[model samples]
Target: MATVSLLDVGKTFPGLDTPALAGISGSIESGIITGIAGPDGAGKTTLMRLMAGLLRPDSGGLTVLGREPLTAPELRLRVGYMPQKFGLYEDLSVLENLTLHADLRNVTGKERTQTFERLLAFTDLHRFTKRLAGRLSGGMKQKLGLACALLGTPELLLLDEPGVGVDPISRRELWKMVHELADQGIAVVWSTSYLDEAEACDSVFLLSQGSLLFSGKPKDLTSRLRGRCLHLGGVEGRRRQALATLLCQPEVSDGVIQGRNLRIVLKDGAARPDPSALDISGPAEWKEVAPRFEDAFIDLLGGGPGGESALAASMQPRAEIRESLIKAEKLTKSFGDFTATDHVSFEIRQGEIFGLLGPNGAGKSTTFKMMCGLLAPTSGRAEVMGIDLRRSPARARERLGYMAQKFSLYGKLTVRQNLEFFSGVYGLSRTRQRQAVDSMIESFHLKQFLGVTTDDLSLGYKQRLALACAAMHEPDILFLDEPTSGVDPLTRREFWNHINGVVEKGVTVMVTTHFMDEAEYCDRIGLIYQGKLIALAPPDDLKADVASAALPDPTMEDAFIELIHRQEAS
Candidate 1:
């Protein structure tokens, strides 16, 4: 049965020239997960709102559960909608939030008790019932929001990026829970920017710039690129350089580094170029690989921008240094009796990309804050460019650049204004500020958005602007905290291209991310769990440590989950 149907639905927010959703038509079936997949500002949220009856379509028709959502008030009782930012009251306890939502949904008495017990067990949040929602980790908060949404036992559930910032393990758990819901005959409409998640769905509606591009099984789309995908290996130490060269080739449509290999997609009907014809150093061999959903999605989007990063090309090269550029020596932080970061120690060399990865509440952020001089450690030291952050805070910060997890930009400011402001904050002279701003506008392709407020820019452009602000001053080290969170894969690739370009120019980088695929880009990764550093090694070595007879080719995610499980067992 079709749980929701759209007949040429069109929606245009007031004051906008283009429609948020245009002539979109699709059917969301019962007892299956249907993904609404797209890049940022691709009308996913708009379509979700329309289905939830929070917004009415400006043209055409939309029906939810066999009736017009906006016209049928009773349908609300049979539908559950969890928005992108799930509305969990921060100060309230988990149980309190669940009780409040139950009251709102009219789930009363013994039924409410039974529903709460089932949901708590299903979400594995039973132990944290008395904990404040605000203190929950990213994954726990998401589970809490889901528990609240499931209060009424709605037959139709709408989830908007519930797995956005959670670790891979938590994301897998959420996927399993949602699949179980689907097994119970609930129609699940999952809106997401993660193509991997979309690939796991029963069907997908691919949207871009407010129009439906494809609506079908993910495999059907992936099958379109069956013979075009190939993996290039043998450039072990210089994969980034090799990938850069490969992406510049006219025959290559999309390429990314995957654990010592470059997975690439050839342009439509393009023949494989001989390894000798490529300009990259070292011997390379190409092996045909299975096509993934991301390859097809990028190919369908007409491919990404060519290899070179314009931002990197515009920057001045840094003087090479043989010593560590940033170091954390026995760093520890505590709140009363609880330790946030316990004796974390590491050193990042010049031009190296070092990643700090962990589950939520795992102290990576605490350690990151200490290194950035945003938080004071209880013991030990954080030094940048050989200067201790505690004793030489100003000098240390002057040589460091930080892009926060949330991409902190003044939402009310225009793109040009934010650039100019950051330049001045970084101590650029008047003339240098003008030059830097102009260069950033050109390099980041922000000229068209100069007049537009940053709040209105798409998430991809906002990320570009944030990185431009962070790098405009040409600091020696860059600290990125979940820098690619919530963005699509294409945008992530573009962001990493810029990072690689900068690293080539001798700037050290320290980053933290939940996306294990992105972890492959790091030179070495430090795994933090329960406030302690559990593992530290190159990406390939980490994956090899967890490889087994049944799983010979363990991915970064597999390594991450396995290492954590091993630590717990020990």
Candidate 2:
């Protein structure tokens, strides 16, 4: 059955002439997971909301489960929607939240109990039922939202970036649960900007500017850019900088930084260079490589599709640490019986970016929170620029900037207003605030939406705004937690450009994220698991260690998987 259908659907908000979904037409089948992929402002959410009957389309036909969704009141009962920013009762316990949802849905007695129990088990939140929803971790909150959405066994499900800001293990679990539900004939229309997850879907629809760009299976979509990727490896310092500058030139479509290596693609489809022909002005090395799904996506979106096999082979790696900025000596945090973090230690050198990596229940959050002074450590200690995090938190924080997992600014205020407010909060004088706000608005390309309420802005804009606010004070140390979550690939790239600029200025960064690929951008990484620093080294070292541990040709993903499995086994 056609679980969801839309024909020439269109919508335009008041005062905006451009339709959010311009003549969009598609059909999502029953029991299938349809991924809606697009960049920021591509109308993925608008389409989902329209399909869920949350908004009336300005024109065209639309139906869910064979009925006109907007007109049929009963359809709401059979459609489960988990919005990007789900509204959960923060003060209520996990079970209380679920019970409230059940009460609202009129689900009662044995059925409710059975359903809740099954969901809790599936989500692995059975032991956290007594915890307040507000106090739950980011991943746990996401699971709670999903559980609430599934309260009534809705036939059709709509999830808007459900896995964004969630830990990798939690994401895998969520996908498993979604597939299990789909196996029972549930239709799921998931909206996401993460191309990898989109590639895993049964079928995908690419949206651009409210228009359909492409719709097909993952293989078909990626098949368009085969044999176009080039893998370059070399030494650090001058060589790394030179390569980055070269790859990010106007001639290159995309450049992925992986430790001492790079995966790059040309902007214009062309023949690959011979390994001997690779231009190596610096001491670093290079090598020809195969194309990846991300490479194909960038190629298709930016230039014509095609590539060559000839490429350069790279040499050995050499790294040089400039100066130590932030150092942690056995940093630890505990919540009574729960040891959230234990004896974790690391250092961030000046002008270098460091990444904190781990699975869902890892000690990353606790460690980050402790470093940022959001939580008191149970034991151990940390320092930022030699200032103690415990002894002189305020002094240390004066030189720090933080962008939390879920950043919150005044939603009702305009983007400019929010920027101004944050500037003042960061202790900028009136004149400085004006200059900072104007500079940010211009640089971030937020001028067009300066007067627009932040509430009306899309997820991507919200992230950009949050970043601008964080950068207003230009702190020496920056802490970012999943800053690129839910952002489109293009925007993510742009965001990284800003981050790179910041790092180049001798800023020290400590970031935690679920994007394993992004870990390659860091100069060094610390892998935390079960409140301990399991591994701390350069990205290539970690991967090499994993490969040495018996995984042949281990990529970062493989290393992470092996690391997590080993931890679990022990």
Candidate 3:
């Protein structure tokens, strides 16, 4: 019998026009990893909440472990759930957190000790047992959350976005540990926005607008796009324009930028894209290839069927490349004896895309903060557009823009109000501020949501508003700190499209991200490890440097991990 069975299950919240989940039906079995895949606001989180018996369905019947999920008192003890933000007591040590969880689950004696040892070893958290939870890295906290959830050997595990804010290496490790649990006869259901991660699942459930889109094996979905997907290689320079053109084509189902190459899927009976049709100054190549999970996903969403035409804004003309616009010479920052950044130096040219990457707590963000003048460097010098930040921080800030990782907008304000507030913050005149806010509303498609409170908007709309606020001043340099975290993949593509449009107009961007795949979008990447710059190169070069015959097809994540390992060995 299936571990979970849903029959026409539905849920709706009061005052909401659309149901959060509707007509959802599926069966999840034991001893396998089942992936729940969807875009933002697709009811992925709602389904998770329902499965854990935290919410009652408004319609249909649901059974978990052969008991009615809504009223099963024993289910709580046998199921482990980690919400999007897994709560870890910041003041408690790693060991203390685990102990508290064990106490809650009533685990005692040898069983508790044995579970603790096994979990610490599996999660690589033994050395950090005494360390406070607040000090542990983003990845470590996720692992610790899993360790706490497994205190009583729960039969079914539900993880909702546990990997959302973590680094690639730690994400891989977390997935590896979860697979082992499934191997031991436990059922695992994890939700994610990344299709690449979903493809590896034993079974996948694709959700859209709270309805079931596709379910069953991941391979079955990709099979539908056989002979339709093509990979365009030898692509260089600004990828935004090329990607934008392809996505707008009637024959193209979907397209994305991937490490100097463009991966696309065509509609049935659609002709191949001719290189001559692309607006380019040089040669571009193309070839038919096997479709990835993302290709199939795009197809399922009425891929070639098209979306809001407003999103396909025309690309601005390429900007002239000037001298070094950003310079960091032997930049270093230290907290007491701990060095967060050591002797990091690099230069960013005008209109260039620079990516900063590393594991959690690897000082990548610290370097970004220093360069943005958010935090002062303990030593060394940095400059933006020839202005010395150390001597003139405020003047340096005026020439730049920033989008923080978290939602920085005020929750109490409306959409237009947020834009107006940001414009004022940038010292714009009342007339200019009104004009800027109106322009932002049109550009970001905030027409329909002008009156909605920022907190009440969907995640995708919230992201668009935040971006609009960032670009309201039209600064030359833009700093995005994990700008796309928690957003759906399609939304991420749209966000990049806007970014590409700006870059074409001579705006330089410096970004830090945990998504290894996003590094492909950068013109150059700098990888930091243990407060040191270990690797600096294009994504393709970094991949080639670590790739061997055994792993010729290395991903950005693989290359990143290899670089960190090399640094440690040295």
Candidate 4:
């Protein structure tokens, strides 16, 4: 039986010219997980808000729990929803926040205590009940939000991008828990930009511009592109150039770098030739490969210019320049008796992409903060562009461009106003400020959005604006902390496109990401667990080394989970 039903539903917001949902007709089955997949502005959020009764449809009919969610007071009690930015009181402890949620749900007496115990244990937050929600890392905060949403065992759950910034381990746990909830006869409707997560669902709905483009099982989409995909391997150190070359080919429908190989899908009816004589990389080794969810989506979206635009301004290649730009030695941080970063050390070179990865609350951010000079280490050394961070914090900051996960921007200001303000702060003169703003508008495609209020912009737009402000002065090194958290796959590639362009001009990049696939793009990655750097290696090397014979071709996510398990066991 269906728990929620929609019949030719349509929704439009006031003052908006387009309908957020157009003829979104589908019934959500009880005891099953239904995933909503789409790009940033594809109406996924609007659809979730409608399912949760947070917004009313302007046309047709929609119902939740067999009742009209808008006018029915009791329907809301049975519906649990967590937005992309789930609201959690920063000052409240984890246990306190859970308790408040239970209270609101009217789960009293024995039930409240029993629910708390079960949820704490299930979420692995039982030992951290006293930690302030604000102090929790991005992944920990996501777990707390899930705990609150699961209160009272609601009949239906709606989660909007709940795993955006969560580590792979925690993300897998969430999927496991959600599947278990489905087994208990609770319907789950989840909206996410992560195409990989969509494959884990019983069914998927793909939306674009308010219209449903495809609906059914995830395999239904990927299976269509089976024989069309190929994995091409170039000479070591020339993979990116090969990818750039493939993106310009008419026969290549979509392409991306995976480990040491470039995976591309061919356009239908294109001539298939031997890979040995390709112009970009002659004698290229190639193999027919199965397509993943990401490949299918890119093909559907008409992939072009894989990372950067064909017309993007050129950044002179820095191929010959290889110098250690940032260095850390025995980095350690402690709060009372608890150590956050335990004797961590690493070095990053100019024009290289370095990634820091770990589980939620695993001290990745703590290490990043120390490197960026936002936090002082207990006993460690950090240098940025040859300037000692401890001795010359101000001078070190001038050479670095840092963007936090929760990027800070003026909500009250327009898009251009915020850019102008940051330009001045970065010490750009009037001529320089105007030049920077104009260049940013063109680079970020923000000309039309210049007058739009920053707070009212979409997640994708906000990301572009934040990045533009960070690069106003074009610092030598860029530090990005979960920069692509809530962005869709296409938008993420676009963001990286700009970053890739600048890196060619001798700009160093240090980043932290929860998306395992993104790690494939990095030159090297550091894996930290329980406040200790346990492993450091290239992405493909790490995966191959950690993968067991049983799972010979392990994914980056699989490798991550196994590494953490090994670390904890030791």
List the lowest-lDDT window of 10 residues for candidate 1: 273-282
Which is better, 1 or 3, measured by TM-score?
1
Q: Please, what is the whole-model Cα lDDT of each candidate in the order they appear?
A: 0.90, 0.79, 0.86, 0.84
The runs of at least 3 residues in candidate 3 whose Cα sits more than 4 Å from the true structure, single-residue gaps closed, are 235-238, 304-321
**lDDT (tens digit, per residue) of candidate 3 on 1-570:** 999999999999999899999999999999999999999999999999999999999999899999987678889889998888758799999999999989988889998899899989988999999999998888999999999888788998998988888998899899999999999999999999888889989999999899899999999999988989887876566666777777878888887667788878899889887866666435777778888888888788877323223322422444575789899999999999999999999999988889999998899889998999889999999899899889998999898888887889999999978888888888787787787777788878899998889999988898888888888787888899998898888888778877777876788899988877789889899999999999999999999999999999898989999999988898
Clashes in each model (backbone N, CA, C under 3 Å)? 0, 6, 0, 0
Model 4 Cα lDDT, one tens digit per residue, 38-143: 8888899888988888888988889888898898878667988888875889899999999888888898899899999998988889888999999887677888
For lDDT, candidate 3 versus 4, the one ahead is: 3
Return the TM-score for each candidate structure.
Answer: 0.97, 0.87, 0.96, 0.94
Which digits, one per residue and each the tens of the lDDT, describe model 1 over residues 174-281?
999999999999999999998888999999999998999999999999999989999888774567777888888889999988777888899999998776676665
**Candidate 2: where are CA atoms >4 Å away?**
103-110, 248-250, 272-290, 303-323, 373-376, 408-438, 548-555
lDDT of 2 at 323: 56
At residue 269, give the lDDT of candidate 4.
Answer: 63
In the predicted model 3, the residue pairs found to clash are none
Top of the candidates by lDDT: 1
Write down the lDDT that model 1 would get. 0.90
In TM-score terms, which candidate is top?
Answer: 1
lDDT of 2 by residue, 1-570 (tens): 688888998999888767788998889987889999887888999998988888999899998988988789888779988887767999999999999999987789999989998999989999999999988877889889989988888999999888777777777778898999899999988888888888879998888888888887877867665555666665445434444465545566677677777666765566543333344544444466766655666676774211210100111121334657788788878787888898887778777788999887788988888888778787888887777778888888778888988767889999988998888877887787787787787767798998999889988899889988887777787899888977888777767766766665556788987898898888888999899898888988988887863567787877777788888899
Candidate 1 at residue 545, lDDT?
A: 100
List the candidate 4 regions with Cα displacement exceeding 4 Å: 272-279, 304-320
Error of 2 at 385 (Å): 2.2
Model 4: lDDT equals 0.84
Q: What TM value does model 1 have?
A: 0.97
